[model samples]
Target: PIPNSYWATPLLLACEYPWTPANPNKPKLDAVLHAGVRTFIDLTENGELRPYNGEVLATRAEFLGIDRQAIEYHRFPIHDRSLPESIEFMYSLMEVLRDNERRGRITAVHCRGGIGRTGMVIGCWLVESGRARNGEEALAIIAQKWKTVAKCNKYPHSPETGAQAEFVLHFE
Candidate 1:
């Protein structure tokens, strides 16, 4: 378990396996290790890495000795199970990134298919990193990067309830 910082938890929650093969692609594993991935974040609220059981696969990767210290799990309860929960998860991700930036650690974030939940987290990253001006811009950038669809608002706005995007835009 990693330290319980405002940031770390969200990152763990941001964990998703979008591009990686269902059972840890060998080539991808090489690239991940090369990238200095100190930890793996699991952001799914259900905490179940569907399709291929991410937890089991990651544990196997650990057994194989691929920087096992980097694997960490963070879980957030998805009470709403709707748009609001999705947005809340993104805020948690922002905290994790901020904390990591301060500690100088590089992390990879993902969700199920790396689309809906995954896109939200990356959108927060763009805004927090100042790569985008606002949530709208952040959404656009994420969509471009991952080709995701975040259709919460009539347009592609961040979820309205979490107040996370609004809060992070000012603070970060």
Candidate 2:
């Protein structure tokens, strides 16, 4: 696999919530709850990660006293980067994130390193937030913020899939 240029988003903050990293250097936990984050959304991939355990995230939420009711975790596989089904899974994940945001919930979203998958989710959020006019512009904004660019599928498995990915990301 080719190395990506960008680091993922550590935490995407909305007006309703103030987000802070678990640790300033490497934010393992999405967003700390006591610091005004009403909802904690863990968007990381699972199934084989030993250190970033899903149970730990749940435990942190329980410890934070953040009502645990507001948290959501949806796992979408990140391997096989060129798969259309994977791309669709990302979209479905976006729908879940967008719904909470629409309800005025402040969400702290994160994945490993806060880059690739994290960046894509953040890009979708920006689009949904109207902070970004389009997907192209959103990508540029994200690249600028993180000092790294997202990859365009150079080996897109199918023309239709490539076109589908391109179509949704119009503003950036």
Candidate 3:
């Protein structure tokens, strides 16, 4: 798990799909509810949701006591770098996060593995928020945070590709 100190707002969490069988120990809906994460930002395409242990995104959010509307799905293709449209999506995500934070709610952002696409967005946020000077620095902070979390859970997490890295650098 990511230490609270790694975040500007401790409520912002980067994660993978929690219902998959591959991660038996992953947090369940109840755990997410307890953690106060009311908003879920999904970066994967809609088509990918079916393979996630057969649980649909809207249904999972309902199970967690969250309204289906609170679960925002921004269909960013996996492995590929962000395009011009992706920047627009990032801006929109910022608005969602800001709104949620104002309401005293936490937000969780995830892709399939929650490494590449998730990390890219988080890194963009870090830089845009002035938590880091640039995308490279933002990504370095994310990598370090992932390393710390990985040491405890043994889950491999980091920005997974150079394309993602470059996208973050040019995201502004």
Candidate 4:
């Protein structure tokens, strides 16, 4: 896991991109490998990729003398601080989670800071997976879980925007 990473479930981890913010934190390829992450989900689009050191895909180790084949990388990006536009995208994301769970694989999902976009996806997954009753419930759960792990804010904004929250609330 990266610095602020935490598990939303035993199998689903919420974490920052390995090379996020591109500063002293650096790429935590070794940490991701050591943490036993198997399914890596990226929720950031290409424009969001510009600020980071580079995109961190499971297939690309971004490190020398290290094998990253064990991790399965996936990209189902949406706009920054936004919800996925298509129902099909949500279906695909959930399908990946289901498939990975069936394989006994632990998955990690990330956007740049692992907050807004990451939280939106996790919240939607929570509702869809029946772990949460509704969007409000899911956001509350996220706030608790995220704060416990990251300590980034006294009042962390999981779905940073109202529309993002609404999408989760009305998520099918």
Candidate 5:
């Protein structure tokens, strides 16, 4: 793992968008290539990541290769501060995370700033992976590790919004 990396699981990490605009705000996969992230699970939409004028909405995801030709890069573009639009998509995302870990792939999951959206998915994973007994425990673990980072979605909770929290709470 990298120095400032945050882990959702030993193999799965939570991070902000791994790219910035300053380096032309492009996808900088090489920057984190040393982290040995064989897989990247990006939970951001196209516009949500990438370089911007005001600031570079970056993440610490182990490594995200939007390069398309990389060994692995999976994107699930849910809106910020929100849950996945569909239950099926959410299931698929969780399945991928679980599968990647089981396969021993060092996977990374990221969203804008690695806060609300990141916390939501990672919290769900904590339950899904059996790291926590339930969503409440999962949220507590994430909130403790992230501290102030968990308040972005208008809630002092890991999943940020009610819908997100509920989704994680009832996640299968």
Candidate 6:
């Protein structure tokens, strides 16, 4: 988990959905509740969920005993490297984060692997929140944070693609 000191109040998390076959025994729901996460922003598209080979996110959350009413779930599907639409979705995501922070709720953002689209959205948030002057700066901060998380978690974590990096660098 990213340390709370990295950002202001109402922590925002970018991670992969936890109910994968490779990690069947992971106590993800318990971890989320323990971390005080009250909001989930799912960046995976419906089509990706259906034809793909993974458990449904909402079903997994429900199975983990998450209260549907207690946590807000926002689904904003962003195709890789799609500019204008991705930018629009980022605005909506920022709005949700703003609202959740106002209510003192911790927010979690997730995609399939939690590096591509997730990183993009976070970079956008950093810029939108005035923590960074531009997309490149935002990405730099994200890269630093990703390195920290990857080291702490003992996993490979970073933005997934050159296109994703470019998207962050050019995001408005």
Using TM-score as the measure, what is the rank order of every candidate, best first?
4, 5, 6, 3, 2, 1
lDDT ranking, high to low: 4, 5, 6, 3, 2, 1
Q: Show model 1 residue runs off by greater than 4 Å.
A: 1-31, 50-67, 77-81, 84-90, 147-172
**Which parts of model 4 are misplaced by more than 4 Å?**
20-27, 50-67
Stretches off by above 4 angstroms in model 2 are 1-31, 38-43, 51-55, 80-87, 147-172
Tens digits of per-residue lDDT for model 5 on 1-172? 3332376667777766665556643444444444666677788787764532111212333225333333477788889888888878877988998788888888777776677777888888888888999988888888776653433345445556778777777876
For model 1, how does the per-residue alpha-carbon lDDT over 1-172 read when each residue is reduced to its tens digit? 1111112122322223533455455444445434455544545556354432356546545656765555544444332213335555556756777777677665655444333444455566767777678867765544343323333233343322344344334433
lDDT scores in order: 0.46, 0.47, 0.63, 0.75, 0.67, 0.65
lDDT of 4: 0.75
Residue 18's C-alpha lDDT in candidate 3? 48
User: Regarding lDDT, does 1 or 3 come out ahead?
Assistant: 3
Model 1 lDDT at residue 30: 43
Q: Estimate each model's TM-score.
A: 0.55, 0.57, 0.70, 0.81, 0.74, 0.73
Task: Determine which window of 10 residues in candidate 6 has minimal summed lDDT.
Answer: 1-10
lDDT of 4 by residue, 19-120 (tens): 534554445655765667767788888777753322444334545434556568788888887778788888899899889888988888888778778888
Clashing pairs in 1: 7-95, 7-96, 10-92, 13-43, 15-41, 15-43, 16-110, 16-111, 38-70, 39-70
Residue-wise lDDT of candidate 6 within 1-172, one digit each (tens)? Answer: 4331123224887777633445565466446645767677878877765321223444455667766457566788876434327456677888998788778788887776677777777877777777789988988887677765533354343456677777777766
Of the candidates shown, which would achieve the greatest TM-score relative to the real structure? 4
Provide C-alpha RMSD values for all models, in order.
Answer: 8.2, 8.2, 4.5, 3.3, 5.9, 4.7
Clash pairs, candidate 4, are none
Question: CA shift at 20, candidate 4, in angstroms?
Answer: 5.3
- Lowest lDDT 10-residue stretch of candidate 5: 53-62
Model 3 is weakest, by summed lDDT over 10 consecutive residues, at 1-10
For this target, which candidate reaches the highest lDDT against the unseen true structure? 4
